[model samples]
Target chain A: MLFSIHADGPVPIYEQIVAQVIYGVAAGAVKVGSFIPSVRELAEQLLVHPNTVARAYQDLERLGVVTPRRGRGMEVTSQAPTACRSKRRDLVRRRIRDALREAAASALTPDEIRNLVDEELTAVNGKRR
Target chain B: MDPIIETHDLCKRFGGKRAVDGMSLAVPKGAIFALLGDNGAGKTTTIRMLTGQLPADRGSAKILGQDCWAAAEKLRLKVGYVPERPRYYDWMTIAEIGWFAAGFHAAEFYTRYQQWLDKFKLDANARLDAISKGEYAKVGLALALAIDPEVLILDEPTSGLDLLVRQEFLGSMVGMAAEGRTILISSHQIGEVERVASHVAFIASGKLLLTATMDELRQRIIRLKLRYEAEPPDAAVFGSVLQTNGSGKHWQAVLQDPRLEALETLKRTDGIHDMEVSTLHLEEIYCALLARKV
Candidate 1:
């Protein structure tokens, strides 16, 4: 899986690694049975502590996103794509919910919030086209 | 598991000044522990004591459960040290120094030293004085790693190196820790430390201010920017406020491990109209922590 990490970001490094792996699987950028970077490899590449990478890998294992295989560091599980799709949706929904909460807190009317969301959605889709 | 390196109330005095006073730390195996502080904050003093180069006047320092002061010679083989200014004989070439250091280690030392030199791309015959500062730093690290020590203690090893060299140095540390080596590095470079260190200890004025895992620090230290209708709530209302800034209805407060109750109370308050809470990077957190003490 290929992803960039922001060392100075608010999100912890390990969480970033876990999220990126899930995102990759969800997007089909990483296929099932393919192995992700080993802890040592990722740590060296990112210049982060290996234990941080290990923690991320462990969390991935617990989430059923990846499994350890003989000689293979961490192979993506068969269920990883489906599992990650739901996880990705939940992650995006949570972010949208937070944005909606902020808009409501700022005293924007429900209709105004709807209009703003629609506007942004159109802008994003238009850019994609 | 027992800590690979530890200090208990370790105190060192120099001419009546307590350089490292009642200091204690526990560094587990495979940890990248960063010791951070301002200049003259006794970081170097503490590192020296841990390496057994300087004796503690009170309490004790231990590495691998052996007394640092008493077992200095025995522990020497198990611990590698790279000082801030690693000075070798000016006329000695890189290869010559490697040969010189090999005398104290097993026969494998020379071979490993050569491998590291090759990896670092240092010319073996380059004299100590002829190499660039970055190359000189790499030489120090290469020599230290040649011993294949279980623990490495570095004092500002990358202080003056360029960005690329510094990144390379930290990358090597990541690989070493993966192999279960404990590393204790004292540095003022908070950004670099944040990237690589699993645990961090902050000291100031000869005393330890805070010690925590990076994850804990990330979870706890928070900066909240609040705008009020009239006047802001007393900064103290936010429990564990480290520092507060801004004036009038606009205010920013950095809180340390704030309680949930305090946040709820702020949300229910009448005057507070808006609040934005964000996590802090290690550099920002360090500044807020030190500024709070001031």
Candidate 2:
């Protein structure tokens, strides 16, 4: 239910919502068959237009990540986590691609970029430990 | 999609000053559209014309396919208008005023409106003259919803409201919009409107400067800062540059719809040292847009 966004990002807000929800499912943050807040509820919480949230919900439904329950409102589909794995991987690839692009722009060689990535991964792991 | 409200070249003058001049706008159905402008920028006049409260001097406005001026009685049934600082019979209590206002609708509507009144927590017995500005606003909202109106025209609905009341008012609007009611709200509260409004129309000195979806506005109006080796003379490379000014090496430029090519051009340029792109907030963008009377 919590997501961060760059308002100026090339990706629109509705897409961000779809990607964030999918990421949540694939990453174990959102369990399968759990209830996601209704569009109005999410819009108020995020302070966005309800239509925006509704569009995201519709996209998620189209992607089979969420399903409409007759009485209980929207719930994540049972197969959503598996369905979202590829999208989650795509998100990871985008971040890695961005980092590599930046490193290339900074004139780093492949070996130097690998070392930088290794150092960053170690730091992240250390924090986790 | 058919617009719930449409106006064409709507003109209005007050004491030789053109309050609304050649204003044309379309509010899409089910959209929570915000008409934003500074005071005396004809927001009130436009709202008046749209709601059929005041006739336009020239041109026309339509709400729900009925001419706003000629067919006001018919259109009033579908549209609920709440003007700024709504006047009420001071002698009447909230309950009395509500009952009086409900006379415009059927008894069933009045029955359904009781829930809304409860939601707003209005003391029906309290005199209108004795209530706070926020309480009076709640009364106004209660009556407006009493008819289950298809369109709600709110002119500065949250102007004098306190923090909690304003929050509640905004919450009610969200609920109403979810029910598929078209809302045209005019307010100076850019931050609040930015959160809820699907579309925005910026008016300055009786003329519209921009009308766009909130997302489009955020993406299109951008501010960029660049540091160059010397006085940068190539701001035109950025598409639709609005204004640019800075001394020798550092220059800041505001642009509309700045493209990636421009950024790439700046990046590859020899003299440019740094470039920063930023999205302006609605308030800042409004000021920048209206600064030159455009």
Candidate 3:
């Protein structure tokens, strides 16, 4: 239920919401059938436009990570965690591929690319620890 | 409750000059409403009347559905205010001042006090007089939030803060709004208000100019840049020309309309090579409204 959006970031707010919700589900922070705050409530909480939250919710519902009930608010689905985990893996692979392509274009050696990846991994692991 | 705050033809007169004249507004439960105006546009006078700090010369105001002046003591506990220039006992530390204010409400001072202090990044031991203006503003905000009143009235909460501090204050206010607390903030920081406010009430020359949702306000006013071959297009065809700049080859004007008819009219004019239509920012709308009043 806690999240922050960066206005100056390259990722749009809707995408950020989607990413956070996915992360929350994958991390088991949001359990199945847990009632997420309403779109209006989350929009007010994040200080963003309601439509932006609505767009994120719509995307989440379409992807089967969350389901909206009549008169009730959105709830995480049972399949949400696995779905989010798979999505996260795909996203990370896509980003790594893109970075590798750039490195190749710049004539960076494989060892140099691997060293850069290792440094990033170490930083991520440090944060997690 | 009826409304957290309500006014009926409230007027404040200083000698022959009217600071606030026949101003009326309603703040609904748990909504972040902004009272917007220039420095001398009666915003302060209206807040003073609503908070019962100053009596109105004519008309009436109610806070928490009680008469603001007659029942000032009863309503004081229900409302928490951070004035434009917060004056505290200069000798007190941040913690002492917070606990002193919280004592009035019989609240558990340290729990809410520490939470607010940490959120605002204020040192618990800092003296009120020793901190910078921005840090003092943080302490003022922390004090107000610690009270946990149903209605919060802030007058230019981040008037003197740098960009980062301003963002932090706005973020805190936005978080409070999410908890269903009513807030009425008066500020010249149009962009921040536009981000957090659900409704905006604009005042000019001691009169209410417009009150609308952010979406409605954005839809009402528009910026138009017109490029013509040799002569500038006639502005009369537009609904109301808010501003006009540039000369022969090109010109720009802000137009207000319920629809795009004025834009279409300009597009149909002769020698009009290009015309760009876009939304107006809150500052632009405010400037246009004040100019119209003048």
Candidate 4:
């Protein structure tokens, strides 16, 4: 999987890996039954500690996103798509809520906030086109 | 599991100055523990004690449950050491140096040393004196790992290395730790070590300031910026602040509040009109914690 890790970002590196895996599965970029990189492989590739990657893999396993495949590496689970899509929605919703909170804290009126959100949606849609 | 390396009140004095003072640390097995500090902050002194190069003035240090000073010779066989500037006989070739080291280690050393030479891409026939500093360091690392020691002690091993060599060194360290080997490295290179270190112990002025797992540090400490409509309260209002900056209406603080109770309280405080709370990267966290000492 393609992972763009921001080592210096506020998010912990392992958490970033976990989120990216979910995002990938949700977007259909990572197919079910495909194996992700092994802990050692990902650690060397990302130049991070193997333990960090292991922790991410362990969390993914617990969340039912991936499963150990005997001698092979971790395979994406069949149920991952449904679980990850809902998780992705929840993640985006939380972010939007935080943004709305910030807007409200700025003393913007509700109408002003609504218009700002509309403008942001239009800009994002334009970029998509 | 017991810590692979542990020290309690480990103190060392160089004449009147305390080079290491009352340092207590635990390096868990299989951990990439970074002894982080600025130059002259007693990192080398602590490593010296741990490697049994210098006996501590007071207290004790143990590696693999053996006293560092008492069983120095026995511990040497089980521990691999790479110093900041590794030195070898100038006339000896790289191959000769490895052969010389293999004599003191297990029989497997010969094959492992050769494998490492190939992996590091060092020419076996290159004279130690003729090789670049980076190559010299690589030779030292190769010899150290060839022993297959349970623990590796590195004192600023990457100081003279180039960017790619440093990355290679760190990648090798990750690979080693994955095999259940413990590594203790002393370095002031916070950004480079941040990715590989599982736990970090911050030392300053010969004293240990903090020791924590990287994940714990990430989850606990919080950086907060607050803007008050009126004058800001005393910095002490947030209880024990690690570091604070700015003044009057605007203020910033790094607090070690696991539950973020302080941040929640400040958000509801009467005069505070705006606030921003976020976790920091390791480098930023290190500086914020050390700012008070400076």
Model 2, span B1-294: residue lDDT tens: 888899999999999999999998999887899999989999999998887789999988998878999998888878888889889998999888877877878787667667777888887789989999999988887888888899999999999899888877887788778888999999988877877889999998898888888878877888888888855846667867777889868889888778878688778888887788887878877887877454
Candidate 2 wrongly placed segments (more than 4 Å): A2-16, A69-72, A83-129, B230-233, B257-267
**Candidate 4 lDDT tens digits, B1-294:** 889999999999999999999999999988999998899999999988998999999999999999999999999988999988888887999999989988888899989999999998999999998998889999999999898889999999889789988999898898889888999999998988988899999899899988999888876677778888877756666645788778767888787744466557778889887788777877777787788667
lDDT of 2: 0.85
Tens digits of per-residue lDDT for model 4, A1-129: 799988888788999999999999999999999999999889888878788999999999999999999999899999999999999999899999999999989999999999998999999999999
Task: Give the candidates in order of DockQ, highest first.
Answer: 1, 4, 2, 3
Model 2, residue B93: C-alpha shift (Å): 2.7
DockQ for every prediction shown:
0.82, 0.39, 0.15, 0.71
If scored against the real structure, what TM-score would every candidate get? 0.92, 0.87, 0.71, 0.91
Model 2 chain B lowest lDDT segment of ten? B230-239
- Give the alpha-carbon lDDT of every model: 0.91, 0.85, 0.81, 0.89
Query: How many clashing residue pairs appear in each of the predictions shown?
Result: 0, 0, 0, 0
User: Which of candidates 3 and 4 reaches a greater DockQ?
Assistant: 4
Question: Which ten contiguous residues of candidate 4 chain A have the minimum total lDDT?
Answer: A42-51
After superposition, the stretches of candidate 3 with alpha carbons farther than 4 Å from their true spots are: A1-129, B1-3, B107-110, B228-237, B259-273
Between candidates 3 and 4, the lDDT winner: 4
Candidate 1 local lDDT, A55-125, one digit each (tens): 99999999999999988789999999999999999989999999999998999999999999899999999
